[model samples]
Target: MSFQSLQLAPELDQALATLQFSVPTPIQQQSIPLVLEGHDLLATAQTGTGKTAAFMLPILHRLLKEPEHNGKVRALVLAPTRELAQQVAANSEAYAQYTGLKVACIYGGANISPQEKALKAGVDVVVATPGRLLDHLLKGTLKLDKVSHLVFDEADRMLDMGFIGEIKRIMRHLPEQRQTLLFSATLDEQVQKLAAQWLAKPQRVGVDPENSAAEKVEQLFYAVDDDRKRELMSHLIGKNNWQQVLIFTRTKNMADEYAKELNKDGLPTLAIHGDKSQGARDKALAQFKSGKTRVLVATDVAARGIDIVDLNYVINAQLPFVAEDYIHRIGRTGRAGKAGMALSLVSIDEQWLLEELEVLLDERLTPQWLQGYEPDLTKVPKDNRKNSAKARKQRDKKHILGKRDQRRRKK
Candidate 1:
């Protein structure tokens, strides 16, 4: 359905039209109306499902219709990472262009003076990371008394990053009577507890199954030696002529090292991790998005919240410890109804991680063996001392292959 059918303000309609947003995404169609009605909501949706706009459009409408209050933060959106906060702020600005909504993003990294000045000027909407936002609130620089809407975008991610305490602190400061909306890809036990505590009879909305990956993404895995994984990655990128590839590593050191190796192969590559300054991270993201950089290697934690819609490929150089992270890693591509591909380089040592990932996605990844780099089929996969029943259950439930020795011995 068209965005105009939502009965948005005239200015919001004009902004949507000028932005070429002809149709509303499914999440938007369901969420915009509820948010505009000022109800607390808990929305579970997968990544790349236009979840960002689900909250942005309604918040913009609310800010525009209400009269301006001086030096008061009317709307607050808390994201888990700096990149997510900036992305949310950018989307908020794009949709609120015609509404004269003053939106600003505050996060750690770079100078805080500018964010301080913006907060002092009375922003209608403020998107922020929890740590930095708490810093401002503690310093008595940001006033949230007037905030009628509070959003925890990526609530699951915040819990993963160990931000529960900070989020609780922020909740204490917010007015007791206000609308709270929580959006996440998955609502695990911890997330459910938070929702129970924060939301008051939240309207439940589910667009996609929890922890589901985008259907447009074609997933594959390559079985290779640990040392030869980079070679395979270089060959895959060059062989397929894949541009705008996002390569994920489990550690910061690996991200930096792999980027260098890919660069040596004549592929324009850069790395983003916690070690790099915010400026470097931003520059790397810009280059990757503009197609100037063909490959971007990043640690899973650092790249967790990146929002780049035109990414053509995703390569998991190393799998994450948490199976859920595998979903978000490949989600960088195949966004907004665009088809994309994800290639994961796996070695015998990483077999357990691969197994865990498969369990989360509920499907076995097809392993494409390269001609020259065939894996040693004789090597026994690592079971890591002893296998627990929980791990085996995860494997059986998801139909993950391999680890026959452990399963056979258990029987």
Candidate 2:
């Protein structure tokens, strides 16, 4: 029930106390003992469920007992994105502070020189994105042969981001006898197959069911035309006096556009996406987190990336193409058993996205219309051009053709 009961080393216990972590989350409680006993683990837990500490604490405890490998990474944590990798590294540093364990983080966007220097100098643990880590491994600058502990944090997202090949290549450099842990929010087919092929006799631990959102998250949908979504969101923020908000758009351009328009509406806003340099993204995140910016517009690149523990509001200005991503977007809020609000601005064209979420969550979702923001029924909204029957047929044709092209490539 408590961190003390986990029987962690005095240093770890004291670190947890300094961080004010009194109780272990469910995933932590179930996975820590098994990890300490040296079992490979497959844990199904969402990001904000304190899953980071669940695996990191025990791994730190074990690593503290061994002498640091001068140039070899003794413990490795693989993340999907730069943001996520940095977050894990931050936590690892905080937890390992008293234990004298050093941590290094490597990802694609930042300069690789510093990462290479860190690896050359030495670190007890390395948290990295698969692509950047693969680069290090290929260059012979980093070796994981001595790694006793490995963690796949957000396995599903890594796979979804098309990093499976890179992950597999990275794994080739690791020894088979090491302890492996795979953590995913959902045990989908891809993640399941990865677990089957990887973890050896792993203990399966789950504190939440598949595709389930946090219980305390208050979800609501606003039915407005696509064209007026920005207006509605600005109005809501201004009327409700929302100081901090995270809004998700479907594309990088949309993110930039939304940020621009919202700023024009007198709301301080910034956009972060793949197009931005890592420094710019980091600055944007800093501003948003520091409450200097009122709204942060982001693409799905940040759905699992941002780790604001006390974030109170999440808005889906545009629905994600993948229905399940709805869960990840809303997950930015309502973390760690905290009460939060997740609002989606749904348009006529995105009804399919909403429906898919319903099927995923196994529940019905009703969209509410604000009086002044409602789409004028008599007048056709511009979204009709994309959602019309003819448009649907065209989209279907493209999808079919794309699949045929994929099959042709396989041939």
Candidate 3:
């Protein structure tokens, strides 16, 4: 159904029309009505599913309809990363353009003076990261006592990054009675616990099944030797002439080293991780988006909230230890109903990790070996080691039972 049937305000309807958002995504369609009705919501939807608009539209409508000009934060959005927080703020500004609302984004890895000034000058909506928001709170530069709407975007990622304590602390500063909305890619145990603790009688909405990857993405893996991964990646990218590639590495050093190696091979790449300054990260992202950089090498932390339009390729130079992160990484591609490709370079050491991912996805990923770059399978697999341990335990158990039987016979 169209957004008009969702009972949005006239201004919001006009904004949607101007922005060419005539149709509503499934999450938006299910969530907008409940949010407009003032119900607490816990929503699970895949990345790149228009979740930002799902909550932003309803909140902007409420603000415009009620017209709160109290010079205090009326809406507080907590995002896990600076990029996501900035994106949320940008979307809020775009949707509220006609409605005359003030939106500000606050996050770490940047100067706080400007954020302090913006808070002091007054803003209706504050999109912030937990650490930076806490800094503002401690400095008495921001107030949430008048907050009527609270949103936790990417709740799972926030918890994964160890922001539970910060989230709880931030919650203590909000009003006792308010509308709470939580949006996550997966409703794992931690997300469920957060919902139970914070959301009051929430309305649940899920667009896709839990932990399911995008249907349009072609998921493939190549088994290569650890030292030959970079070679295989370069071969695939060069042979396919793939542009706008996003590669994920497990560590900052690996990301940097791989980016350098790719650039040396004439790939024109840039790396982004925690070690990079905010300015550097933003510049790298800008370059990539502008097509100035062919590849972006990133760690999981730096890759969060990356919404590159028409990003067609995502290479897993190194698989994540956590299975859920694999979903998020590949999600960078196959957005907005576009076909994309997700390729993973798996080595012998990561076989167990791949197995764990397969269990999570409920499907086995058959590995394809590249010519001249095949993995050496001479070493014992981790599964075999586990099996040997299990055998030893079984033998000990039999011995103990035999001795007990002998004692019983003597008795």
Q: Which candidate is the best by lDDT?
A: 3
Model 1 lDDT per residue over 1-411, tens place: 788889998888888888888898888888989999998999988777888788888887888778778858889999998888888888889888888788999999879999999888778889999999999999998988888889999888888788999998998888988888999887677778889999999998978777777778888888898889899899988998988889999888999899999999999999999999999999998888888988999987678667777787999888776767777888888888898898888888777666666666676666778899999888876665343345647768764333322343453
TM-score of 3: 0.92
- Measured against the true structure, the TM-scores of the candidates, in listed sequence, are 0.94, 0.92, 0.92
Displacement of the residue 387 alpha carbon in candidate 2, Å: 11
- lDDT of every predicted structure (CA atoms): 0.84, 0.84, 0.87
The true-versus-predicted C-alpha distance at residue 294 of model 3, in Å, is 0.2
User: Model 2 segments beyond 4 Å from truth?
Assistant: 378-411
Tell me the tens digit of each residue's lDDT in model 3 across 57-144: 9998898777575778899999999989988899888898887788999999999999999888889999999999999999999989
Return the clash pairs for model 3, or none: none
Off by over 4 Å in 1: 378-389, 397-411
Candidate 3 backbone clash number: 0
State the local distance difference test value for candidate 1: 0.84
State candidate 1's TM-score. 0.94
Give the C-alpha miss distance for residue 106 in model 1, angstroms.
0.6
Name the lDDT value of residue 335 in candidate 3. Answer: 84
